[model samples]
Target: MNGRGVITQICIIGAGPAGLLLGHLLRAEGIDCVVLERHTPDYVLGRIRAGVLERVTVDLMERLGLDARLKAEGLVHDGFNLTDGERLIRIDIAGLTGQHVTVYGQTELTRDLMDARHGRGLEVVYEAADVALHDIESDAPFVTYLKDGVQHRVDARIIVGCDGFHGPSRKAIPVSVGKEYEREYPFGWLGILADVPPCNHELIYANHARGFALASQRSETRSRYYIDVPLTERVEDWPDERIWDELAIRLGPQAAAHITRGPSIEKSIAPLRSYVFAPMRHGSLLLCGDAAHIVPPTGAKGLNLAASDVHYAAEALTAFFRRGDNDAIPAYSDRALARVWKAERFSWSLTRLMHRFPEDGPFERAMQVAELDYIASSRAAQTSIAENYVGLPV
Candidate 1:
């Protein structure tokens, strides 16, 4: 609301879940912030994402006053089934770890955050064009962008980049200071979103001779499913009926028998990649969520990881603002990465166990089956898997 543009204590880039949630947390602490998003609110809402909510993620939502809608509409899953071609094994996460995950669509969660933010008369500028960062390593960092054919600038004490992978925030980190490590899977997921009842009440992840297929849901009447395909595959390559037929074959008769196939309202192929950037904080710029790291969708850690990052950033910022002691601010990257690496390991391991790697030999495949079998038979193994699925302490 300042004359120069939107001056505030913090200027967050990208109004996705991470940015929005960070804004809400900061505002709750009486900190001033403005969110800048490149896409329209409707476009942001139109995006589809994983629906799994970790225990910690749910706790964070409760703190943000967003748990009521989630509790009322979200499905609580005690366990889920994992299949390795023939036999299906159920992992009782709730029983093993005393915790469970919530099946709530990221879209709905994001909408809730947006609603809460807007209802409080907070600022979230949509269609922010050509977002650029200036002197982030300096004490006086600022942000500039175009809106309504006019350029705007904001002088901010701290800049938070909650933008996704392709966002400029990470790219602005100066190559010398930012070191990126990435691993791209040779395969991608061809996922479908349909307005039909899910095949099962809980998610079923199956690995068949053909490939990997997952049966998931966003709501009681809406289903989200996915099948593994080559990186070169496109959504056009898999028609609606073809996808259903493939799912039926891959999921096997046990789960597929109840599948209610219908016209897909949305369909796309998502490429999987495990990426992370070192020292998420440099100068006054701090990266959160996808801006710092990315995980494969298999472990459902993407959103959860983002939530953890925002948690650390918000807490550190609060300390700096309240006590004027900024020691914790510099340790943000280390604190966030400790958990980031753990989540990354979990996601990577799960993806390897439940997917048919193109280059996996018989030995590799045997090890995967052996690990799955151990988890199915051993209480210790099950507890380990359950703990990771339910989420580690933030």
Candidate 2:
């Protein structure tokens, strides 16, 4: 509220889960920080995102004592299934890894974090327009943005970019300083959200002869489903009945029989991509979440990866502020990227396994069938998939 500018130890760009989670963690440690977002609170909550919660994500919520609703409402999934149109190959994550994932919507998780902000004394500035990063390579970093037609600057020892891929924070880094890595898929996921019971209690990732389809749910009554479509496909071309009919065909008989078709509340087609930017840190600026990397939604790693990044960034920032451990700040990039790469690999592998590529011939199709067969027959294969699905140790 200072007329000149605001001063804090850390300035977070983006009030998404990644940014807000980092803000909460730092606040718990008695650190002073401010979060800036280009959108309104409602806009942030309206973004439909991945629903699966890895243990790392749930743990962070538990640590903040923000799991009251999450624990009561979140569905604990012991395992999920992978099918090849005919048979269901189950990966018993709880039995194999002694761990499970929670089916909690990213929107609800963000809401939990947002609701706790005022009570916890966390400062988040929404509708922060034209936000930009400045002097990131220097010892002192800061951010500037316009709020309510007033220009303001926030001075901080560190500025974390939770602002996401399209945000100004990542663009602030000179192209010469960062190496970009990306892979764009030939197809996109056409998703539909409806107020209907899911076809299955557990998630089913199906690889049919036609294409890939995933059956997922946010709650007992709310369902989300997706089918891989050519990048050229448009949402307008597929109506509710068309989607449901396609889902019935692709998800196989078991799922189709139980599917309760209803009008879609939300529907969209999102192209898939695997992207990573090297050395997530440059001088005083550190990147977290989508600003650092993006994983295809195949393995449900998008939001979970962001939570892991925030976990690392929070630890590093807390160390620097409390113990004056200079090494943690410089080492944050390596620490976070270690896990990021693994999640990226899993997502990529799953996407490849389930989706039928445009260029893929009979040989490629045969290989996918062979791999699914191997995974179905081998306990070791199931174990590896289970371990990754539940997420690796943070």
Candidate 3:
């Protein structure tokens, strides 16, 4: 280490999937990089998140030769259902779009990346404290953090923030330089995870008069379900039985009949929000994943979106470092944001179609019903949903 800092070609903040995946990708190309995380390894893997994997994500893993366990364990979902409390309107994504989404847990995918770190020679410093970014607008950007009672610094040619929305990298950018777009929903998702079989082989997104519900699975033997609840409600207020009962009603009688209720392994209330920050890059600092944008979980795009960000970032960094391409660095923001806006739109539209807003009255409800009816009847509508559901090409 130099007197100033540990010098590297690239420095990545946040050891979440986005950061880890980018680290691995850079390493595979013989690039020197380091990742910093504010949390322990266990804490990072403990977070419960969406897992629908698009082709872009699958391709990256495959390209890295990291899909052995994923191929062996991931479930290939051909289609998913949308309902209006009466019947299911199945969108055959694979049939219509010739594409499929893999049902894999975010935790599991992170585990795969984590386990492969040592073999790939990727350095990830967990429990990094008070991480701060410096000179992002200048050619030489560096990161500093306190670890194990010693303050350390990392000087790099580039800094990528995969640290999520609340992380320091994004905040380091001058507020005047970036524009914020956000929509906070009136309700939140109350999700329960259990070690039981899913009610259905495929996902079911239901819009009942009572509320919105989604029945999903992490594996053949593990299920995850969610129901929209007023933001005022607390996890303590809804007991296991109460959540199960609500799921039964909102998911409709057909899905309810097959529900295998079990003790919740994890349960929480997550507020829904759609947020984006324009110009994902500011000088030497580049933002990826949640640091740049966020989407509601309605379309299961959160993790996949992060993966796509890493994909674009890895390519851009590789070009800059390997070929001395100055243009790729500046072009990264626009390329990543193009896909980000589309995913945000899809998630927002799906959330609007499925959730019952407190301000929604007869007209809004009728519009939702009409839209659902049109989607059910029209092949073109289903094709559009299928394309977005499986994800757009990167």
Candidate 4:
């Protein structure tokens, strides 16, 4: 101990979006916090996968004056395209919900948050640290970590675990009372970011006899595309030519103009899955972001859900620090789970509608097409999509 004090105001684990954003929020409220991340700054900023930003995410960033970089570099999409080989259906999200999805990568989001934290002179410990939490029952709980080859103990009033799915925070919860819901699809997305312009004005989610293909953009010059492949397929098995050939076939001839095979800046496999853990809090170790739940990328809810988690966690912490009341803290899991489940459902629905199931017969295929047609034609169905896509009223 440096003898500065026996306890810190707050300690946040994982410097991902949730952890970084929570640190920023708490700092804004004059609360001091230390963020410990297992990965280095470079690794965290570059190694993570990309994701879409929902309208609510934009709103929150704007509110925090953190939208400058996002607005400058992000692509704003009005809607998405659902196609079945020859015919295309465009669901205009702006017209339907008065909001649009932003094509900002999760890595960019992490960079922005990291920048904001640094701009405010916040302390974020990157690289492997001996992070361990103890004395949760005490008024002053503590986190012990190593930095610069030296062990340091931080006694904090509260520890907010914003570390993602693989973090240690969730394990700290002894016999969690809530249920776990999860689904792992047989297919995984082979995502590639290339130095090519997008083939379409909006995202194209194609359901084909071969597999699923998604056409999205990162910027005016860079395109992000994905093809559904066997989960067992390795990235090393896919060469540049093979990847483009698959994309060309699934995207149809219109994609030929924009699908130039160039040096890929990024390529990785994203497994399709939906997961949730009830009651996001266990004592002072409150789980947020992927630490508590994860959703398939089909609905573009992963990063948005993380932001939402931080939002609720911040509010709860504010209430606790201000009033000494535990109501918000206890209700944290319930409140977050409501939206988590909604996103889970929406992601599953979207995945089912756009991906061809291996076991589906003709009847199931017809029903899926009919459901798509209904969504495109029915005002009520469109409104439901709009609400969920734009975000559930925050």
Backbone clash count for every predicted candidate, in the order shown:
0, 0, 0, 2
Q: 67-90 in candidate 2: lDDT tens per residue?
A: 999999999999999999779999
Candidate 1: give the clashing pairs.
none
- Looking at model 4, report the run of 10 residues with the lowest lDDT sum: 1-10
Candidate 1 lDDT, tens digit per residue, 29-147? Answer: 88999999999999999999979999777888899787899999999999988987668888898899888999999999999999888776568999999899999989899999988
lDDT of 3 at 217: 97
Candidate 3 CA-lDDT value: 0.93
Which 10 consecutive positions of candidate 1 have the poorest summed lDDT?
Answer: 1-10
TM-score of 2: 0.99
Q: Write the per-residue lDDT of candidate 3 for residues 1-394, one digit (tens) a residue.
A: 2224699999999999899899999999999999999999999999999878888888888988999988999999999999887789999998999889999888998999999999999999999999999999999998999887788999999999999989998999998999999999999999999999999999999999899999999999999999999999999998899999999999899999999989999999999999999899999999999998999999989888998999899989999999999999899999999999999999999999998899999999999999999999999999999999999989
* Model 2 poorest ten-residue lDDT run: 1-10
**Residue 343, model 1: Cα distance from true site in angstroms:** 0.5
Residues 1-394, model 4: lDDT tens digits: 3323335688899998888888888877777888889888888888646557887678778877888989998888888877877667777789988888888878888888888787776688787476778876566788877667767777888898888888887777766455677888989999988888778868888888899999888777888889999988999999878988898888877765566678788889988878887678877778888988988888878889888888888888888887777787878878888888898899899999989988889999998889988977787887787778778864
Pairwise lDDT winner, candidates 1 and 3: 3
Per-candidate Cα lDDT values, in order, are: 0.91, 0.95, 0.93, 0.82
**Residue pairs with backbone atoms closer than 3 Å in model 4 (clashes):** 8-155, 280-333
Model 1, total clashes: 0
Candidate with more favorable, higher lDDT: 2 or 3: 2
